[model samples]
Target: MNSFDKLYYENYHKVYRVALKMSGNAQNAMDIVQEVFLSLFDKLENGGEIIYPGTWLYKVTVNKCCDGLRKQMRFATLDVAAGNEFHEVTIEKQETRQIIEKALFELHPRERVIMVLYSEGFSYKEISEASGVKFQSVGKTISRILEKLEKKLKGLNNDLY
Candidate 1:
């Protein structure tokens, strides 16, 4: 396999998972991943060098996901203004995974990306680089996000009781 092919094989799943978490839609995630790789391909085709391909892929993926989410939010708002009634689809029994996902989705897109990257075992510096957060603030932001999630999960659990 070629170098580009090897790079894709190594990073495809990681980028896809991050995209999926950020966008919360498989189709959107796939599209974002495709866009990111295409960007890398273009850069390489032009003889541009990337010292850290993984970090570059992650930054691009996060930016694309954020853009897509912003567009989606705008459409959702327009739909609401057009008298569309949003319906909440409740699972019969909320599994732990479902509950966690629910809370995660409630967070702002940037917060969600930061939390997801952290969970994926990216170091603070990696998360900062990927998510466009400052390195110094990644830890504090994470702590804040964790507290918010904790409260949200607690509230959700209480609702079930």
Candidate 2:
């Protein structure tokens, strides 16, 4: 196999899992994965070299997720403007995963992506590279996000986090 095929095979699962976690749905994850690989194919076709393929894929996946969320937000705004009443029903009794899912869904798209990357054991430097946040600021930003998550989650289950 050529080098591009080899890299795609080696990295596809990693990128997909990150996208899945970021998107919270398999359909969106698959779309983001396809988009990322399609972009990669174009880069390789144009004789462009990616120094860190994994990091680049992560960056692209997160950006695509953010784009999707932004589109959803815009649609929601338009729906509200059209006089549609959107009611979100909350579960009274929730499992740990459900609670965490709700908390993650409440976060802004950028924060949600960073939290997923961090939970997957991406280093601060790697997150900075993928997220385009200043390298030095990743820790502080993560700290704040974590505190927010903790505060929200602790109410659901004190021992589970």
Candidate 3:
């Protein structure tokens, strides 16, 4: 197999899992993985070399996920602002996930992506490259986003009262 093929095979699962966790849905995860590979194919076709295939795939996957979330947010915002009610589930764990997802869903796409990538063990520099943000801004954003998440999670716990 060629280098691109080999890299794809080796890192496909890692990228997919990251996508799945980011998306919280299997279908979207599959779509992001496919999109990443398709982008990889185009890069290889154009003779672009991947010195770090794993990192490249992670970035692509994160980009696909952020794009999907942006589209969803647009639709959701319109629906909510139109006074259309959503039928959200109310189970305990599901409620917790919803609260977390709601806060995550409210963040700027890049911030949300960075938080997830950071949680998955990527350093600030890695997150900056993956999320296409300035490297210098990563630390500030990570600190701010974590503070916001903590506050939101605490608010969620209170809401359960």
For each candidate, give its TM-score against the true structure. Answer: 0.82, 0.81, 0.75
| Clashing pairs in model 3, backbone N/Cα/C closer than 3 A | none
**Top lDDT prediction, candidate number:** 1
lDDT per residue as tens, model 2, 76-156: 111111112223332333345566777788788889888989988989999999999899999999999989989999986
Count of backbone collisions within predicted model 3: 0
Cα distance off (Å), candidate 2, residue 94: 6.8
lDDT of each: 0.82, 0.81, 0.77
Deviation in Å, model 2, residue 151 alpha carbon = 2.5
| Model 1 TM-score, all chains together | 0.82
In candidate 2, stretches whose alpha carbon ends up further than 4 angstroms from where it belongs are 74-94, 154-161
How high is the lDDT of residue 58 in model 1?
A: 92
Maximum-TM-score candidate: 1
User: How badly does each model clash, as a count of residue pairs?
Assistant: 0, 0, 0
Per-residue lDDT of 18 in model 3: 79
Q: RMSD of each candidate? A: 6.5, 7.6, 6.3
